[model samples]
Every structure is written in structure tokens, then in C-alpha cells.
Target: MKDFLPVLKILLRFVIVYIVLVLLYQFYLNEYENDVVDPFTRWVAQQVAFLQSIFGFPTVLVDSLKLHSILFQTEGRFTTRMVEGCNVISVVILFSAFVFAFYKGAKTFLYVLAGLVILHILNVLRIVMLNIIFIKYPQYERVGHDYIFPAIVYGGVVVLWLIWIQFFALKKTDKS
Candidate 1:
């Protein structure tokens, strides 16, 4: 019983933190009416547009109040739309919950903060590249959006988790 308690505690903490963060995110979403786009998603869309522009795509972020979405258009053609999921807050929440679940010390915040910043940057770049994919290769757009790009973002999160585990989170069971 004693041996299993630690695992159970970590699992419990993970679940609790995950739930709380999800609920708080939901609360943030609920504040915006159906006709409005939330600020965070809009900010992400701006970042995507900014990157695309820097890449010489001449991008414009068009937010439709009625539809509550921001469209990424290049060369006066729609390349992609920024929905709530594209904002990367959910990914940040997931990463944070994991870091907190394995709470060791104050460094947990540093790891989570660094992870989130990287994830946000990664997502913006993902959208910019995905926009190019949508523009240049229409057929692969679905594959990139559904599979390839997501792998990149999640792969980054995994790398952060690994770094945390490798340096800051030595397990109690490890003799070394």
C-alpha cells in the first residue's frame, strides 16, 4: 500500500490540476458572447499574420465579428482560419498541469513558463508554415493540419517534459 501511494498521489494531483485549469479556461471562454472573438485567440492570429508577413507572404488577419474567427489571407486569398484551438492555451494548460503534477520546487514554474513560451512560438510558426502549405500545396493541407503540424507541437511539449525529467525531476526511486 505504501509503495503505491506515491504514484496515486501524483495521479491525483495531475487530475486535479488538469481539471482546474480546464475549468478556468472554460470560464474565460464563457465570458465572450457568441458574436465576439476572445482576445487570446485574436492575439495568436495576429502572431500568425505577423510571422507570415515577415516571411514575405503579405498576410492580413481578418476577424469576422459574426463568425467570431480570424482569417489568414495572403495575396487577398484565404489561407487559414484561427479558431479557439489554434490559440495554444489548451496546450499550455496541459503542459502546466503535467509540470505541477510532478511538483518539485520553484523551478517548476520556470519549466512550465519556458514550455509555454516555446509552445506558443512553435504554434505561431506552425500556423505560418501551415498557411504556406495551404497556399502552395492544397492537397497536403489536410494532412499537415491534422497530423504533421500537431506532431511538431506535441513533440515540442514532449521534449520540454523530457528536459524537466532529465534535470529537475530525479525520481525518488533513482539511486543515482
Candidate 2:
């Protein structure tokens, strides 16, 4: 029990930081709903528009999902909402905190930071792909959005965690 004190302290710090960050995020989301959400949504929508333009997919912007404008192009409809579902910031922060708590030294820190950046890029690409999928096959949107994209995001996190454990944590244990 005495030997585990350091580990427990690190974990507790991680949890506190995580909670604080999450609360701040929530507060920001609530306080600046339109200012934050709209810009983000617009940016994502614009990116989708650009991608669709390149790919020659038909695209349209409706007031909601109800109205119709055109077809094929990616929709930016849900980009500016309450930041629920597929928000990458939370995941990135959590993964970063986890790595920082468990790992030691600059090399491990750099690797974890790099991994986090890559994960976020992949997540953005995932969003783009999901938008395309939603546009191309409207029927599959539910499955793609709810399940498939989440698996990709969370799975990436899990893989990163495993790598950290295997390379840094477990290796150190084995050496000592």
C-alpha cells in the first residue's frame, strides 16, 4: 500500500484536472453557445463544402435536416450544436492527461503529444468522412454517426493508451 502512494497521487491529480477541464468546457459551451458553436459549425460546413466541391458530390444547406436544397454535397448542419457527440477536444485532453500522469521523461511526453495530435487529425478526417457518408447514404447516417465514428475515435484512444502502457509503463517495470 505504501508503494502505491505515488501512483494514487498522480491519478488523483489527473482526475481533478480532467474534471476541471470538462467543467470549463461545459461552461464555455453554455455561455458562448452561438459565438463558439456557429463559427465552428460554419468552419466545418465550409470544409465539407470544399471537399464535396473537389469530389463532385452534390451539396445543400437546409435550415434543419427537414428542408431540402440539393444533393451529394456534405452538409454542415450539425457542426455548431452543443458540442455533444464526436467532440475531439475532450478526448485529446483526457488522453494527454492520462499519458502525463503515467509516463515520465521528455521523450515519452513528446511521443504522447504527437500521438494526441495525430488522433485529433484522424478525428477531424473521421468527421469529414462521416459527413460524406451521411450525404451519400442518408439511411446509414444513424449507424455511421452513432456507432462507427465513435468506435474509431475511442478505439484510437485505447490504442494510444495501450502503447503508452506497453512502451513506457510496462517496460520500466520489467527493467526494474
The per-model lDDT (C-alpha) reads 0.87, 0.64
Q: List the residue pairs that clash in candidate 2.
A: 58-71, 58-72, 58-73, 59-73
**Per-residue lDDT over 30-149 for candidate 2, one digit per residue giving the tens place of the 0 to 100 score:** 764434243444444555556656676545533333221112233444321223334477787788778777757786678777886777667766766777676567788888888998
lDDT of 1 by residue, 42-130 (tens): 88888888888888898988877766788888988998898888888898888888888889888888888889889999998999999
TM-score of each: 0.93, 0.71
The ten-residue window of minimal lDDT in model 1 covers 167-176
Residue clash pairs of candidate 1: none
Model 2, position 116: C-alpha lDDT score: 67
